[model samples]
Target: MLSRRAALRFGAVAIGATAAAAGAAGCSSADDDRAAEPDPLLTALDAARRDADAAAAAAAVTPDRAGALAVIAAERTAHADALATEIARAAGEDPTLPSATTSAAATSAAPITPPTIDALRSMLAESQRGAAALARSLDGYRAGLTGSISAAVGAQQAVLLR
Candidate 1:
């Protein structure tokens, strides 16, 4: 009774509506299981913190830029510490205990390269991407703490980029 295009569109909409109803009825998708796993977002933050530290160390800068980099690095380190503390708090562990596992990413002692503004630009770009990712991760973790961290990283990127 319907044209071919209209029939296809109707079928697509019907499928989508069915999927939406299933989702609203507490259906489980792969994405829904993300929160059940050990938080990958924490691992990502750990990696980003290391990268921020590396960037600060590698940046060839004047005194002003040096000061800014120092602040940025300190902020990043503080962010890592805060994340560790919050995670520990959630698990009823003493957050003060320095867990070696916190920084357990397998990274190399390789040197940072191309000591120039180009390098700085690259790091800034990377940091911005990390910030955006962290922001998106708010849904995967505790909204309060994760959102705060995302905002902090985003603000840091803005300052550093300027």
Candidate 2:
């Protein structure tokens, strides 16, 4: 006669085996479907570019804040470049080529109004939030890069801009 403990162990093992089989069978299609979804990093890259553009524009119109805005612009630009390189690498493309983000930004015809210091502050806060969230979802170097970017943006918003 089967013991209660032994039966429970057998059942658990059977269930686990069944689950593993199902997971393995589903993995290929899931991977293919996931490939169709856009990478979250692209959004982050675009935000960085926009923030850099905004900061540069703000600096141009608000001379008093140019010093701080220039720093923000340079940092954000660097962030954008890093993100673009990562995105390209992940896509198995040549990092030397201009990324979609860069091309789009360059061809963009929309005129941007120079923002006030308050507006720049708000934008930086938003960018920091997005970067922090993206950092949470990523791992490895991508995670560290975004985490660093978020921290820098936080400092910019809290200390530099203040």
Candidate 3:
């Protein structure tokens, strides 16, 4: 009795649920009972950090705006360092810097014009949103973690948004 689109949507949802269940099961499989990898998340965070850094650098070229952007850059650097530490703890090794492809993807995207204070503020707002999302994604990895690392990281991210 369903329309064609409704049937298709239902089928897609069912397939997606099945796939998610399978993936969850696979994580518990005996053959490869290792923890889930955090490299992908780290890589994403690195790229985001790089983009934010680049934007901060560009903003710093103007003397009047340089001080504010320098603060933003320092905060972003701290965030990247925190993410790297978490990635290292999760992976049982130091986090490697992202590859050329990732660096390019992060920094070489299309340019935006921030010709005024309001425009620059808007750009920084967008960057903060992205950073917040990345932080949230990384927070999911702290389920069984000890101590207050996750909380600290979340606090730092909140400071960045401010």
Candidate 4:
């Protein structure tokens, strides 16, 4: 009884309506599921990274101490990058930390003739505390990561102190 054109239009309309309904249902039930709260471990890691970055920037690295400075800076930067990625993945968002270039610039700048021991010590303490906090708060693989980082920071402290 319907014209050919009318039937084709009706079929297209039906398909469109079905698709829209399916999409709405899926979004309402599934896609809406998201993390209600940000992970505290992520927050701790981010804080530690920021402090490490600032400490590296403040420390006085002379020509003789370049090697130690580089090592310290590199480790902190690497941890930060890894943490940022993990945090973003957990939250389903892009990374929120400073980009690598800006972070590296602080370490690359000329330091005082001799290294600042006090500043380095402060930085190490901050890093260690951050790691410890994360270790205490998280478990499983996250606990391992924080515990390892805390130990590593302690070792770095020894190296700086020596």
Which candidate leads in lDDT?
Answer: 2
What's every prediction's RMSD, in angstroms? 13.3, 8.3, 15.3, 6.9
Error of 2 at 104 (Å): 1.7
lDDT of 3 by residue, 52-131 (tens): 55547556566765665566557556655555656565555644655443455457655544334454445445555545
Better of 1 and 2 by TM-score: 2
What does candidate 2 score on TM? Answer: 0.78
Worst 10 residues of 2 by lDDT: 101-110
Better of 1 and 3 by TM-score: 1
**Model 3 Cα RMSD, 1 decimal:** 15.3
User: Deviation in angstroms for 10 in model 1?
Assistant: 64
Candidate 2 regions with alpha-carbon error over 4 angstroms: 1-31
Model 3 stretches astray by more than 4 angstroms = 1-40, 94-123, 134-162
Best first by lDDT, ranked: 2, 4, 1, 3
Better of 3 and 4 by lDDT: 4
lDDT value, residue 59 of candidate 3: 67
Q: Cα deviation of 106 in candidate 2 (Å)?
A: 1.5
Candidate 1 lDDT tens digits, 1-162: 899999999999999999998887674555466547776456646645665666577544445477767676677677677777766665556878755446453243355553444555565556556656655756544555556655655675567646
What are the clash counts of all predictions, listed in order?
Answer: 0, 0, 0, 0
For model 2, residues 25-61, the per-residue Cα lDDT tens digits are: 8996887786788878888888898899899999998
Candidate 4 regions off by >4 Å?
Answer: 1-34, 55-61, 93-115
> All models: lDDT?
0.62, 0.88, 0.53, 0.67
lDDT of 3: 0.53
**Residue 113 shift from truth in candidate 3, angstroms:** 10
Write down the RMSD of candidate 2 (Cα, Å): 8.3
